[model samples]
Target: MNVLSLRNVTKTYQNHTAVNNISFDVPQGSIFGLLGPNGAGKTSLIRMITMITGVDQGEITLNGKRLNPDMILDIGYLPEERGLYKKMKVGEQLMYLAQLRGLTKQDAKRDIKEWLEKFEASTWWNKNIEELSKGMQQKIQFIATVIHKPKLLILDEPFTGLDPLNTNLIKEEIFKLNENGASIIFSTHRMEQVEEICKDIVLINNGELMLEGEMNAVKQKFKENKYSIEFDGMLPAHLKSDSFSVVEDTQKGLVIQVKPGHDSNEFLQSLIQEGIHINSFQEILPSLNDIFIKNVNNKI
Candidate 1:
């Protein structure tokens, strides 16, 4: 069940392509990561999805219907930039934003109260927006973003600033929101967040789709033949092999990048012959950051 689909979407500036023939589908009720480095056109694609800006070519669909004005109410967006009034009272700001999203005053108040309590920020209701910390105000804006309970939520740089504890708090809320059947499109340059929470991802680099698919499959696809081993046995200090190259070595262990077209069994058998005690050995899979670097380099 794909909740959002972009088909051959292309956006161009006066002399440069911002997004080039990008296409991907975000499954229903899943956390989808939209990732890219600075100036990679990821924001352009997101803007097109939210219809904040129109694409020069291609179409975007939500809930099996073409993108339209009515879809705005169904899609709630928290842009990379904050969108709250600084001088307004916290509670008053939320109420105004909620109504703009098409919620009735009574319903918005009820939901805002529940959300404030859930976030344990109900006591700050009367605080002036400028009185709050950046992270605190971020939470208030976050509450407004999802308070309407839209079927689809688009959050860009959702965790830009915060102490670890508050970051964890919002992470918990995001997980809970997903569990309640809301599809989420999480856009951020933070690769670790994508690795930690996203089930699928679409990466764009320099105005083109670099990759898009299940997280697990993408990791496996970009996997290199490598392993990390921890041992204390007296293996030869000057050890080298054609099949395996030492990536890093320490008194405790060694990280080896195995060469392609080599048999793992043969390599291990050689280690056994050399009397190296293998305490623990595990294959090395490319992290999201690693994959991102490889992707950008490939494009270059």
Candidate 2:
């Protein structure tokens, strides 16, 4: 089931188009990536989805109904810009935001404490927002956003300002939320994170969808049929097979590009018969970053 969708969505500014007639669906209980470079209309699309701004054309639906005022509670948004009051005490600030989300005072306080403890940030509760480090503030904002337990979470550049350790902290929380039944729309330029967590993605470039599909299927579309084989002995000049061409050679192994319709088993057997003792054999897959750059260049 689609938790969120846009049909023929478009946004235009004074003599400029930001998002242009794009449409996509994000399924319930899955992580969806909204990706693009700077000035690529991704921000405009995201704003429209969250209703922070109105669309110039088209319609949006959430949970099979037209998006409306009441639906905002069902969605949580963590924007790139931090919005906490600098002088506000962390715990009090969180409690206020939670109440704004419609959570009762008692429930909000209980959940905020749990989140703080889970992130190992309990010590930050008494500190003012300005006194906390960037990573600490991010953790606080992240906790505040989800304290109400909304059905949908939209995170834009969610991992910004976080170190590797804190980044993973938020990542684990995102995974946990999905496991407990919240659909996430994760938007960022970090393609590796998308590859690691998102099962579905919609990529936009210059106001158009560069691509959108299940992450694995989309990755398959960009495969180059490359493989890395590490062995203990010298490799033969020919494997008696034209299916693969050795692209890189080292003292320990060879990296080859297998031709389309070629049999990898036959190639491996030839290596084996040549007395090459295998240490490791693995297919090489392109990362999303690699594919994203190539696709963007192709479109340009």
Candidate 3:
């Protein structure tokens, strides 16, 4: 079941359409990527989803019901722009945020303590937000966001100020949350991170939906039948074929694109017939980064 659904949703600002008839579903318990280039209306869409702003057209639903203010407590949002009071103590800040999300004082205190300790941030409770580094402050904000144990999490550029260690630390937590039945909408410009974590994705450009699907399925949809073959000896300097084209010849391997309607097995057999001892052969699917660039550029 989809935890969140947007149907023909659109938002406009001062005669400019920021989100134009966009629609997508975020499945329950899935790590979904919400990707778009800058000025492509990602922020506008997020604002609508989080109820920070209302859609000018269409509908948004949570758990099959029309979205309402009561549903806001069920969503945990970590905006790209972090919001934390610099003068506030970390513990007090978290408690305040959690209470606002409908948690009881005692429950908020307990959850806050557990999350801080889990993030190895027990010592941060007494520290003012300004006393922490950017990464440290992010951890505090993360705790506040999740302290109420919301079912849907919208994280935008969540790793921005984090180091490698802290990045992985938060990544592990994200996975844990999803595994424990939370649905996540991860938004970022980092395609590599999306590739590693998201199972499904949607890309938007010029305020329109450009691409959407399961990650592997989307890659297959954009694949050009390219294959990478690793062989024991050097490729024949005069190698030529009408069935395929060599796109790259390097020390690591030979990357070839099979001509349309040509079978990959036929290409492999032809290489073997030419006396090349093939060690490994695998299709090189287009990366999300490659697909993102191609689609966005095409729209432009």
Query: How well is each residue in 107-168 modelled by candidate 1, as lDDT tens digits?
Result: 99999999899888989889999999888988998998998898999999989988898889
Which residue pairs come into collision in candidate 1?
Answer: none
Q: Which candidate wins on lDDT?
A: 3
For 135-233, candidate 2 gives per-residue lDDT tens digits of 888888899878889899999999988899988889999999999999999999989889988999988999998889999888888889888988875
In candidate 2, which residue pairs get closer than 3 Å at backbone N, Cα or C atoms, i.e. clash? Answer: none
Question: Lowest-lDDT window of 10 residues in candidate 3?
Answer: 233-242
Kindly list the per-residue Cα lDDT of model 3 for residues 1-300, writing each as its tens digit. Answer: 999999999898999999999989999889999999999999899999999999899999999999999899899999987879889999888888999989999998888889988988888888888988988988888887787788999999999989999999999999999999999999999999999999999999989999898999999999999999898877676566678899998788889999998879988777788888889999999999999999999989
Flag the better candidate by TM-score, 1 or 3: 3
Q: Order of candidates by lDDT, top first?
A: 3, 1, 2
Poorly placed runs, candidate 2 (over 4 Å): 123-126, 238-241, 269-278
* TM-score, model 1 to reference: 0.93
Model 1 off-target regions past 4 Å? 232-241, 273-276
Give the number of the best model, judged by TM-score. 3
What does the lDDT read for residue 201 in candidate 1?
A: 95
Question: What TM-score would every model get versus the actual structure?
Answer: 0.93, 0.91, 0.96
